[model samples]
Target: MRAVILPGKKEVQVVDRPKPVPGDGQVLVRMRASAICRSDMSLYYGGKPLVGGEAAKTGTIIPGHEPAGDVVEIGPGVRGLQPGDRVAVYLAIGCGHCTYCLSGYLSLCSQWKCVGFDVDGGDADYMVVPAQNCLKLPDPMSYETGALLLDNMGTQYHAQKTLGVSGNDTLAIFGLGPMGSAGVLIAKARGARVIAVDVLDSRLEMAKELGADVVINSTKEDAVEVLRELTHGEGVDKAIDSSGNPAAQNAALDSVRKMGSVALIGETSATTINPSEQMIRKLLKVYGIWIHPIWMFEEIANFVIDHNIPVDRYITHRFNIEQAAEAFRLFDERVTDKAVFVWD
Candidate 1:
């Protein structure tokens, strides 16, 4: 089997490795579509991974957390899933008995392991994952869309759902990267008036195509002021930051009307916030979102199907597994919006 590994500093190589056999309660997923993510950038740079612990520090682990494929083999005790079933692989592996895992918030478990970072992932022809982590894909869904559902799309859905976004809401999304782009799709499906903001014209343009009612180029205009004007001075009803940029994060907090909600979905280590003005004074409700719960995959997938979301629209590039180097490089340099490794 051929798999991608990052030796260090944005270096990717395809190396041969023995095929893995599923263990108890696990299934062997034949790679079909595995999406590369911004989080994977850490692995590309040899930095700490978004998930997992010391294990990910090794930088030898396969680097793909958003993957979907067909089950080719089921291990002993794996009853619900069988060979030939189409499923999306949930990235987190947690102890089944933990409170978080029992409640399906596997990523919140103290000892949770990320499939691609902590262990082997779908950068190869076959990857082993817990059968319990497999979510059945609708017959109408493509493998690429299935890959998005678990991570990018699912995270945005969870954030908005938590914020209770709906038809009455004017949703402002900052950072039109893949995550923010997914936010636009989910908000539109929920019937919200979508105001998409980004520093890039390319992303803002993509947002308009995805049904955003308004697109604001933050680099060209004061996003906060423009959002207020668009909402008729009341400000947006819901705001989300998917950029992880400090400025964008602040804009999300500042652009929401008093009592309006905001969800921060991007990963950021440090950012300044004016709680007294941007939060407390506005009586805001803010949330930090990283990943969605395991059980929500089915619901999110159904939403994607029911809304006829153009999930494939987010994909700007696709490469075979052997092209991992160029794929990661282009993605890192922001030349590609959403790139995937597809297998025939």
Candidate 2:
């Protein structure tokens, strides 16, 4: 079996490895589709993965957290799923006895481990995961779409729901990366008027095609001013920042109307904000959004199917395991908006 391993900086390797077998309560899935994400860049660059404590520090685990495939074998204690089941493996594995895990908030559990970062992942031809971590993928869904459901698409879906985005609201999204692009699709599906902001013309163009009501070029134009003007000078009703860039984050905060809500989905370090001005003065409601709880996968998938949201629109490149080097290179260089590794 071929597997992708990032041993260190600027290196991508597809090495031959033994195919894994399922252990108790686990299932071995034959990998079908996996998506490359911006977060994977940390591992691609030889830096430690964002999760997985000591395992991530070793820097040898397969580097894909967004994966979906077909079940081939099930170990003892596995139930309700069998061979031929099409599923997307939720990335986090938590101590099942914990309250957070019991509530389906696996990522919130104290003893959570990430699949691709902490153990072998779907970057290989076969990988084993706890049966409980597998989310069923509907027959109508593509493997690529299934892979994205846990991360990019699901994150935006959770964020918008948190802010209660609806037809009555005007939403502004900063950053047009895949996450931001997903936000546009979800916001539009909810009937919100969407204003997308980005520095790149390519991304802003793609955002428009994905149903963004208005697109603002932050590099060439003033995104805040454009957002205000589009909302008839009242500012948008809600804002989301997916860039994690400080300037874009601040602009998202400033572009929304007083009392308007904002969701910060992107990960960033310390970003200075005036408490009195950005929070108190505006009476803003701000949410820090990470990947969603495991239970939300069903709702997100149904929403995707119900609204006919085109998840494939976010993908711009596809590769095989053998092309691991070039795949990460293009993604790292920002030449591809969203890239997937597809199996035969």
TM-score of each: 0.98, 0.98
**TM-score (C-alpha) between model 2 and the true structure:** 0.98
Q: Each candidate: RMSD to true structure?
A: 0.9, 0.9
Residues 1-344, candidate 1: write the lDDT tens digits: 99999877878899999999988888999999999998888888886666678878897898789999999999999888878999899998999898998999998889889988899888889999989989999999999999998899999999999999999999999989999999999999999999999988988999998899999998799999999898889999999999899999998898899999999988888999989999998899999997899988989988999999999998999999989999999999888989999998
Task: Look at candidate 1 and tell me the lDDT of residue 187.
Answer: 94
Tens-place lDDT digits, model 2, residues 1-344: 99999876878888998888789999999999999988888788876566677877676788788999999999999999999999999998999999999998888988898888888888889899999999999989999999999899999999999999999999999989999999999999999999999888999999999999888888889888888888889899999999999998899888889999999988887798876888789999999998799999999999999999999987999999999999999998888888999998
> Any runs in candidate 2 off by more than 4 Å, and if so which?
none
How far does residue 151 in candidate 2 sit from its true spot (Å)? 0.3
* Per-model CA lDDT versus the true structure: 0.91, 0.90
Name the lDDT value of residue 14 in candidate 1: 96
In model 2, the Cα lDDT at residue 171 comes to 94
Q: What residue runs in model 1 are displaced by over 4 Å at the alpha carbon?
A: none
